[model samples]
Structures are given as C-alpha cells and as structure tokens.
Target: MAPPSTSKLEDDVSVAFRNPSHHSNCAAELDNKHVNDQDDYKPERDARVWLIFLALSVSAFLTPLELTSVSTALPTILNDLHGTDFVWIATAYTLASTAVLPMTGGLAEIFGRRPAMLASLSLFGLGSALCGAAQNVPWLIAARAVQGMGGGSMASLTNIIIADLIPLKDRGLISGVLALLWAVAAALGPVVGGALTARPGQWRWLFYLNVPIVGVAFVLVLILLNVRAPTGTFSEKMRRMDWIGNFLVVASSSACVIAITWGGVTYPWQSPRVLVPLILGLLGLVLFLFYEARFAREPIVPFSLVTNRTSFSGYLQTFICPFLTLGVIYYMPTYFQACKLASPVRSGIDLLGFCITLGPAGVLGGVSVSRLNGYRVQAWVGWTLLIIAMGLLSTINEDSSLAKTVAYPALVGVGGGIVYAVASFPVLAPLPVKESAHALAFFSFCRAFAGVWGVAIGGTILQNELSRRLPPSFAESFPGGVALAYATIPKVASLSEPARDAVRAAFAQSIAVIWRVMIAVAVLGLAVSLMMKAVPMHAQTDENWGLEKSRDGELEGREGTEEGSDEKRIEKESIEAVI
Candidate 1:
C-alpha cells in the first residue's frame, strides 16, 4: 500500500518522536525520504482505533460524571464522614483540573498523545482508587486532586486525538459522538450516585464504580493502540516539556480558582483569605505570560495561537459559553430538588431534558459539518437557542411548571450541542498537522478554565443573593424577632405556616434573580458568537516538510497509481472484511 500523504506522515512522525515507547521501526526506515513511496504505503481501517475510542471515551464519562454525580452523593459522604467542609471535596478536583489543564495540551505535544493519555488515565484511576479507600474527608479531597490531574489530561486529549486522525470535515461527526457519550454520563450521574448512596455502601460506590471502567480502558489502550512516537530522540523531546511554564500556569490558575471558590462562601470577598490568593494568582498569571513570552523553549501554550485574532476569539467564546450553559446545569438541579421539592431521582430525570438532547444535536451538527465544510451557521443558531433558553428560564419561579423547566434545559442543550460541534474548527483549522494536538490541548484548557469560573461566579451570585434576600424577608416576617429567633427559624421545619411561606418565597425570589443574571451571561455569549470570523474548512498542511498536494486534489506522487498499488490496499481490504 502507498504511504500516507507526506503532510499526514509528518504528524504521525511528530507523535512518534514525542514518545519513544510508541515508536515504530518503519518510521526510522522512512526518516530521510522526501516522499513516501506510493507502493510502500497502505491504508486499512483498524478495529483497534475503535477500541482506543472506547477507552478514551471512558475518561470523558468519568470527568463530567464526577462533576454532576458528586452532588447527589455529597450529603451521604458528609454524613458518613461527619464533615462540614463539604465544598472542598468538589472544589479540590475542579481546582486541580483547572490548574493543570493549560499545560496538558503542551505536554501532549512534547510527550506524544498515547503516552500522555496513558499517564493521565493512570493518574485518574489511581485517584479513583484512593477516593474509594478514603477514611476521611482530607483523604477524599487529596484523592480528588490526583484524579483532577488525570481528568485534566482526559478532557484535553480527547480533542487532541480527534484532531490527529479525523480530517476537518469529519471532525463534527466524531465530536457529536463524543458529545453523546458525555451527555450520557452527565444525565446518568445523579441517578447513579443517588442509587449508590441509597444502598448500604454510602458514597464509596461513586468512586468505586470508576475503577472497573477506567481499569478496562487503561488495559485496552495499552494492548490495542499503536501510536507513532516523535521522530527525534526521546531525551531531546523530553527537554522540551516546559516544566516552569506548566508550574506557573498551575499556580496561577489554582490560586485564582481557590479565591473564587472560597470568597463569600468561606470568607468575605474583601478578606485576606480571598484577596491574597486572588492577587497571588493574578501575579502568577502575569509571571507565566512573561515566562512564556521570554524564557520558555516550548511554552505550555504558544503565544502565537493565543494572539491570533480568530483563535483568540474562539477561545474566548469557549470560556464564556460554558460559564452560562454549565452554570445553569450546576444550579438547575438544586432549584428542582430544593425549591421545587423534587426527589433526588426525580430531579436527575428532570435534568435529562438538557443532557439528553445534547448528544444527537452535537452529532447532527458534526455530521453536517463534514458535508457543509463550515460550522458558522450552526454556531450562530446554537447561540440564539441558548439565549432564548436562558431568557425563558429567567422567568422561572416557585410556581413555574415542571414542563417549562424541562423545555428551557432542552433548548440550552440544543445550543450546547451546536457550540461544542463547531468550537474546535477555529482552533485546529489554521495550525499545521504537527501542531493539532497542541492546539486541541489549548482548546481543552480554555473550556476547563471557563467551567471553573462559571461555577464560581454563578455560585457566588446565588449565595450572596440568597443571604441578602432571605434575611430581610425573615426580618420582615417576624417584626419582633430576636437573635435566637433568627438562628432558630432557618433550622426549624415546624415553623408557623406563614413563616414557612415567607422563607420559601424568599428562596424563589433569590433564585429568579440568579437565573436572570445567567440570562445576561448567555446573551453575552450570543454576542461573542456573532463576532467570530467564519473561515472556510481546509485540509491539514505540513509546513515543516513543505509537502504540497497537486491540482487534481491528490498528494504529490499519487498521480498515476491505482489504489491497489498502495500497501494500504491490503489493510483496507482487511478492514472491509471486518466491517
């Protein structure tokens, strides 16, 4: 079979040089060849690729599942461990993942996708194992940190891998598949966690359930995947790992998230506990930029990519869009369970309206991109839907019907599906094939960063609004209330009917305010989407090698050869048989 186009081969070579463990001898044999011999190259579909996809998808399942599932089990874990600092259990993982995400993309570039992915999976599985065995809250939090390291990589690498094998035109379809998988996990997490907690095992099963799936995925990848290592000596590539840049990035991002998570919840926004960390994180971020611009040989994120107008805009949209969409996801379940008085199971099922719609919409968007060669239309349509959804949702109140809640979420899901489908195009379109992995990593980093801030800002608003509004209502309801009355009222279920009504009304009003704020954020996202420049989809290029395709749309050297002349003929035939 004929070898792949020189441009495609360079990407494969880059991966090989990045990780020596996955290097193939064939790569060395063809190292100095200007053009791969058409007769020598073969193309065949490998079932192993599907296996790898399944393995990688497991990580995707765990990442979002961890996010949505933990809420249901938090009460159980807190009760069993006798813990008050419940927020830390969730925050630790988010902090660690957000901190590490910016660098994982660069690390994948330097280390090769396969090795980087395996390492991430191992870390994630190990964290899950530790969490399952935790005897206390501290242990559980620590384990989550480890899990975050792995989780960060998982999110980044999934995008990186798609950019590697799938062409620009086909990416949408693959992305849709990925969205479906993520949606399944998101939709299932709460119900699964509630079931586990309801059983005698408490919350341990939440962590334990990840073990078998992750373990199987890890083993499958190791055995079935054959990745081409980077083209140069392993040590040479290792030197390019950008450790200082990575550390600074982690420090800055972690500090910032910690500040956001703690402010107004654990400490006043103006207090030192919040202010000091926020300042430090900002400084760390500044220093990281300086380091990337001046000192680092291989910056964790290339300044060029960040500076590119289209790419920069794309990243900004990613960061902001999730803030609006995911913030709603985070709070809506609570609104249902707490304000609407739905059971945990019922709330989980209700939340499915949004999550369930995401997969098919994402898939359809993606598949359409393959044919349409652009996603600008889909992007705009999605933002419109999201804005409408947010607007509809903002009108929700204590008296809102369950049907209205479900409709808005499903609309947002449709929008999310479109956004997720097209977001990758801008990031990967301008880069060379060799840089696709890094580009994807950066994309992942931006998404994670946005999610962190989304939750933090949304939570802060809800908490502050609740505190300010609830107390005034409480005071007005009991005109002669003393300090003890103020303290006792919130804790008592047997309060006078009027008092209960007042408190519930206060909650309803506060939540309405929060949802209105979310609506504004969603509108901002819609605006950002409008500014995004639409570029025509182009095939991947390899600038490093100067390989170009011919006018007939074939790579150079493939002009006269029949398809069977390539070695891939045999492999393609085998693949066909399997199919």
Candidate 2:
C-alpha cells in the first residue's frame, strides 16, 4: 500500500553518527562518500553555478521583502484605500501562498524547474503591477493573492534547486548566504515601505519597484538555469501528477484561512460564517490526506515524510518558529505606533537592531552546523534563547524605555536567525536525495501556513484585549469591535491626556499577550526539537535533477535507469485490486 522505505539506507548511515563503535563500516562509507562529494560536485567552483545561485538569492529576496514591507505600510494603506478590513490585506497573501505550496514539488517534477520558476516570476511581476495600480481594497487583495502564488512557488523552487545542485553536507555556507539575503530584505522592507508611504501616492512605488527587479531575475533564470528536465510525453507527465490531491489541498487550505481570518473579527465566532467553513476545511484536509495515502498514484506528501519521529519533529519546529517570528514582525510595528507614539518611518528605523542582528547570527548558526556536523544542538540553543527573549518581551509596559524596545527584539533575531537557518537539516538528513523536492515543499508549506495563524491569532488577542482595556465611552466611539485597532492608531495622537494614557497602556498590555503566547510556543518548539536525532546530512545531490552541462564544455551521458518504474507498477496493481 505504501512506496518502499526510501530512507532505509540513510537511516542505516545515521545509526553510525549516533553509535560509531558498532557501525564502523557505515562511518567509513560515509566519510569516503563525503570525499567523493567534494571532488564531484562543488558548485562553489563553477562560475555558472555561482550565477544561478545569485539569481536564486535575488528571487528569494523578493518574498520576505514583500512580506515585511507590507507590514510597515499596512496602517497607511488602510487609510489611503479607505478600507475598514485590514485583516484581508495581510491574510490574502499568506492564504494564497500556503495553498499553492503543496503542489510546487510536483510542478517542478512535471514541468522543469526553469520553466516553473520563470512562470512564477511572470505571475509575481504581473501581480505587483496590479497591486500598484489598484484603487480599491478588494482589487488589491485579489492582486496580492496572485503575487503570493508566485512568491510561494519561487520560495520552494529556490531551495529545491539548491538541493539539486549541492550536497546537504556542503549546503551550510550556501544556506547561510541565502539567510543573509533574507535578513537584508527583511530589514530593508520596512524602511522602504515607510519611506514610500511618507509621501502621498508614493506607496505605489513600493509595488512598482518589484517589477524591474523581477524582470532582471527572470532574465537571469531563463538564460542560466539549465537543470535536467524530466523525460516523458505530456500525457505521461500529466498522469504522474496528483491532481485530486492538489485541488483538495488548495480548496481546504483556502476555506480554513478564510474562516480563521474572519472569526471574531468580521463575524462572531459562533456564527455560521466562521463555524461552517472551519469545520468543512478541517474535514477536507483529513479527506485529502486519506486520498493521498490510500489512492493517489503519485502522492505529493508521502506518509514516509511525516511518519518518522525525526522528520515529524522537523516539520513541527518549522511551523512553530515562523509562527512566533511572524507574530513579532507583524505586531511590533503596532507596538511602536500605538504605545510608543512612533511614526511609520521611525518605527521602521527602530527595528534596525533586530534586522542587523538576525543576518550575521544566521550565518554563524549555519557555519556552526557545518563545522560541528550536528543540527540538534544549534536548534536547542536557538529555541532556548527564543523562550528567554519572549519572556522578557512580555514584561514590557507603556512606560518601558526605548532600550528595552530595541534590545528585546534583537534577542529574538538572534534565536530566530539560528533556528531558521538550519531548520531543514533534520527533515533531509534521514531521507534520500530524491525525496528532497517533496520534503522541502512540505517544509515551506509548514512555514507559510504558520504565518497565517501567527497574524490571525495575534490580531484576535490584541483586539479582544483592546475591547476590555479601552475606556468604555472611547471604545463605543469606534464601532467595529476587532476591526478598530488599525483605525484607532491614527486617532491615538489626538486623544486627551487620561484617555490617551489609558489607550497606550491598553495597547502595551494587549501586545504583551502576543509575546506571552510566543513564550509558550517557543517552549513547545524546544521540546519537539529534542525528538530529532543527529542524523548525518546527505553527501550526494539528486542525480535525476542535477545540472545539464553544455555539450561544448563537458558532456555527461545520462545513465539508462528506469527510475520509479517499480513504484508505478505497484500503484497500478493496487488500483486494479481497489482500495
């Protein structure tokens, strides 16, 4: 009923890392394999490979840039667009991104990586153009969904391509470099968004700016990215896709996000608007998993990916870390604006402490994993630090000093940076190289999906707290219960003394709840991460997806291998028998 255990040989190798005395042959084999890996495929030594990595780095930069920039500019966007619903603006991007992530591995397999990547770039560019031109709220939300689809696919593809090019053991420094780019983009995003929003109609430039950058990255990918395409007719390729699985995932994810976004904010939690979709979405997901496990000819998320304790822990940690990090990123600006009375530009500048620390720490973390050849310790250290940071953050009040404001988030940066850099190791370590695409797609999906909950839950807590904390008369003046936080920010500056102080304290206290929840989540992450064993990283890249060298330079013949034929035959026999 299931495919052969792909990780069996790797799991045997991993035992050597944990107990070398009893498995000396495994150790010797692993060491010799690494020696061969160094000589055979070192992308660092190839100029063209460097260019391709550069292209991926640039593409990777765009996703975080859009995410962070939108956060700083959101309050301003709501005012300019005359929109009451702030949740949809943020939720739409993440929802679309999460829904599209599960199928990207299959897309890369069916269509070559280069073509899939180029298509994603095109969608991103087009969405950016539409976002810049949008004059209303709904139109902008729709356009952001489009941009999200592209961004999500690109994010998965970059890692997928990197896995194709470099062995896992050698990917540390490379991962660090990409992490640095991410930190830079994240740090720059808020500042850029704030500067653009400082002037009337200037916010359009935020979206417009992405177009030219996308154009450059697209051209580079088209010219230089020459990875191997799968061999098959269109019909054959179509048959291999898990179409039903993809549709179920997309539809179910959308329904769930819509429910989460609307619950307690746009509608009462008890209302059918919230309950029906939530229930249906949960049921749909269960059905989807069942279909994938029992009936699909080629499953996108094989049960093997999650059934193992080590990989399951990896997925859980991946989901939780981003859940905490995004809550901080999205809500910290609100704290600056509402409690500290900082302007959009000032708030963005205030975040430099966090932005500056995250990048270098990530590089250090990745390098440590490479040098030490173990990811479990680094992850433990990271989660421990994050727990401490979140605890300190919860102690902030209205009268807290700027030093606390700046220093606390910087602590988060350090811990988050470390965890984020090496989070993929445990998931990939015990798995075969061929499973990288599926595993990484699910990895990216978990990360993106967590963001949806992070923002939604943080907003819900803040709104409910504000309702209780704000003066009764003042609360009544702003009609919509949960929707009033963003609207109340601009008005905070004009309030009378006692009321003003009350509102500030309310905001400070409400935001602290978000941090308190992060503390609990971080602790859980730390505990879950302990399930990860010191599995050895892979020393080989997927042979099927490796780069295709130019004929004039270096000709490498493809081995005649009937890959996945046995799995296909098994699936055919099982289907004929019926589930």
Candidate 3:
C-alpha cells in the first residue's frame, strides 16, 4: 500500500516560501520532534552555510571533472598500461557509480550527511591516489570504480545538502549557479585531460591532482558543516535501511547498464553477453521495485515520491532531458571531426560556444525561475528550445559552415542550461524535507544512467544509418566496413577519391539521421515537461499558515510544554530500540 497520497505528500512538502522559516522550521520540528536538538539553524545569509555550499560545489565540480577528463586521457593511459580491457576503464566507473547511487540516501540517514560526505570525499581521494599509482589497466579500472562511488555520492549529497539548506524560493538561483559551475567543469575536463596526456606518463597527474583538492574540501567540510543526525539507536537505524533492496537495485541496474553499454558496441545485441544481462536486469528491476513497495522497512525510492505527480514528472523529465543532452554531447565532436574535417583541437574549441552559452543560460534560467517564482514556464521554454535545436541540427549537411554547426549545437546547450536550471526544484518542492535526499538521489541517478543509454543508443542509431545509407559502398570501401567502423569515428583514408567522398557523405547523412532521432527524443522530453503542474511558490505567513507563527513569548511557551514530553519520548524510544 502507498504510504502517502499524492496530495498529502505535496502538503507534507510544500511550503509558503514567503515565510519559509516559519513553515519549514515548524514542519521540521513537528516531524522529527527529537532529532534536531540544536534549535538554531543557519539563516539565508549565514557565512558558514554559503561557505559549506561552496565547498560542496567544488566536490560537485570534481565528479564531472573526472567524467569528462577520462575520455581524453584514456588513450594515453591505455598506452602506458596496454590492456585489451581498455573499454572497461570507462565502463567500470560508470557501473559502480550508477549501482551505488540508490544507496546514498540510506547511507546519509545512518551515517549522517556530514559523515557520509566526509566518507565519500575520503574514499574518492583514496581512489584517486590508487589510480595515479596504478601500473596496469585492470588495477586502474578498479581504482576508477572506487573513484566513481565517491563521485556518485558527492553528486547526490551535494544536491541533497543544497535542498536541505536552501528554501524553495531561492533554490533556483543556487541550482543555476551549480549548473553553471558544472558546465565550466565539463568543458574544462577534456582540455585538462588532453594537456596532461601531452607527455607519455603525464596522464597519471590527472588523478594525482585531485588528492590535494579533496584534502582541502574534506578539511573544510569537517570543520564548518554539521548536520543533525536522525533520532534512533544505531541498531534501529541499521534495521530501517533496506540493505536487500540496495543489493537488488545495484545488481539489477548495473546488469542493465552492462547490457546496454555492451549491446551493439562490444557485443552483438543478440549475444548471450547482452541478452542474459538484459533479461536478468529487467527481472531484477521489477523485483527491486516490488521489494521497495511491499517489503522494505524504508524504501530507497518511496512510493509517495514515485506516485506524486510533480515528483514523478521531475524524475521522468530528468531522465529524458539528459538522454537527449548526452546524445548531443557524445556525438557533436564526431560530427565536427568527421564531416567538417576539423582537428581534435579545433573540434574542442568549437565546443566552447556550447560551454560558454550554457553557463549563463543556466544562471539566467535560474534567475527567471527565482524572480517569477514559477518553474513551469521555464520548463516549457527550455524543452521547446531543445526540440527546436535538435530539429535545426538535422538540417546540417557536409557543406554546412562551422558557424552554422557551432550555432546549431549551441541551442541544445542553451536548452540544457535552461531545463537543468530548475531541475531539482520540482522534485524536492512537492516532497517533505525528509525525502529531499531520496529525490536528489533519484535525480542524480537519472543523469548517471542517461550517460550509458545516450552513448549506446546514439552509437546504434548512427551505425544503423551508415549501414542503411551506404549498403554496398559501405562494405567495399573501408578496411573493416561494418557498423563497428562507424561506432567510433571511422577513418576515411582507406577509400580513394570518389569512394572517400561517398564515405564522407554517408557519415554526414548518418549524423543528420541521428540528429533527427534526437529531435524525437527532445519531443518526448518536451511532451513530459508539459505534464508538470505549477505549484505555488509564494505564500502569506501572517495568517499562521503552514508552520506555526507564534509571538516570541508564545513560541517559548509552546517549546517549553513540548520539551519535557519530547525528551522523555526520545529517551524511551532510544532505550527500547537499544534493548
């Protein structure tokens, strides 16, 4: 049975933003009644809180830094370590990260967010240290997976902490800033990786560089940020966690990712390598959901959050939006290199337009949401722009100028910035403060999961189009003239003159075809964005609305009355739980 109705969930979460302190403070007090003994929390302008947020942002930036950096550095790393298992280098981290995300909330609940964050940071630092020192591809892959766990945790925890600290009214602005920082990090990652790989052994420095930064962030968090622990005996907290559910989800989702990633890339879609995992992963997913809904004491993704229109809608939107964005991100450089005949450096430079526009676009989108105190309009605007961007990109041929190509992809970036600007608001807004961590975990999971799907599906579409567009010519011209050649930028030198022209034409046409498919994906995302209902952001607090707004004396009196019973109940519960 569902624990809370959709309307009830909304009421439990939604606040009168105008007087957030009263609504949220009292609501939190009522719910916990025991956990938060430190009655004074940080105000909006607290230097300490903002400092903590900044520190968290650095961790957030670090996650994407590793993600984008590895792509450019992998070849160099491969050169030094030299293993056929090179493919697993990237996939390992992705699998570990995605598998670990569902556990983050429960970890936070048990360990407390501060301890969880510190643990994650420490683990990532250790992983980075190991990665820098690795002598073999397999060992490096293992380190990357360890790093990914920390990266995944940091990504989820940052969002959860942001929601914990910021009120509904101001979250958009902060979200925008974070998005901007991510954009900067993502854009810089390739450059940093490429620079490090300029020398044969320099690639190891990429991981090495992170250790010091992580150390600083760890010290800062340990010193400045403190979160209230949930009220429970350690055993009760352990019992409350859905350990079985976590295992099932990790197993199921990791299996599915392995299937999707290897399918049509490393293995044939029909190969047992692909099919068995696909089948098992699907079964596991169903089992995980069933356990969460029916048997788990505390579900990772609670039914209330899943069923609530706004929360579910946000989840859908997050999954699909990134699915589209990742496709573009994955393939755009290929388009520049193959069709436009640009050097890798030139290609990376061309991508700067996207990097630059998205940062401001994200911030602007956030500002719009914050000032308007409405997110639906922003959603419509963002998705519509993406749909239009993808559609425009489909028109590009080999003859299309760099200016046109640059401008076209920039639209997708702009749309990404806009859509992602308000990403967390809808998910967290309609859920209680308690569920914020779960919502953020789910949201972050969508982004991570989309990475696998985007690259695999986009590669499949491009390869299929190449096979369709140049059937006889495709087989004859290239050295290895099957779909796999097109999988990663197919070299055109194997073909002489007219055949080479045919190859280029095929490649360009194939990219256009992918762009058209992306348009459909964008359309799907836009369609879902329309389903998001507008929740009110502003509320009048003078009427003793939501959280109690008692006068100073009255507030003290109420606290005094509740203190004795609350303390007694807490003591009794703790003792009973321990016993």
Winning model by TM-score:
2
Looking at candidate 3, what is the lDDT of residue 91?
A: 67
Off by over 4 Å in 3: 1-44, 73-88, 133-137, 231-237, 463-503, 537-579
All candidates' lDDT scores? 0.70, 0.85, 0.72
lDDT of 3 at 150: 89
lDDT for each residue of candidate 1 in 1-579, tens digit (9 for 90 to 100): 445566655555565566654354433444323234421232222565566677777777788787777765665566577554555676788777877787776666666667888898889989988998998889999999999889888888777765555556556777888888878888898787766766545578788788888888778767755554456678878777888988898888888988987887668899999999999999999999899888888777777777666676677778777776676667776676556656556667788898899888888887877778877788788788887887788788767888998888898889888888778876666554656666777788788887778777766776666666565645444322122111222233455676666555655676677668777776777777666566665454332212123357454445445453444443333333332
Candidate 2, which segments miss by more than 4 Å at Cα? Answer: 1-45, 552-579
Q: Give the TM-score of candidate 2.
A: 0.89
lDDT of 3 by residue, 364-436 (tens): 9998888988888888888999989999889988778878888988888899899888766677666655566
Question: Which of the numbered candidates is closest to the native, going by highest lDDT?
Answer: 2
The digit string of per-residue lDDT tens for model 2 on 460-483 reads: 788778888888988899767447
- TM-score of candidate 3 to 2 decimals: 0.81
TM-scores of the candidates are: 0.81, 0.89, 0.81
Badly placed stretches (over 4 Å) of model 1 are: 1-45, 199-201, 231-238, 471-496, 541-579
Clashes of 2: 0
What local lDDT score does residue 225 receive in model 1, on the 0 to 100 scale? 51
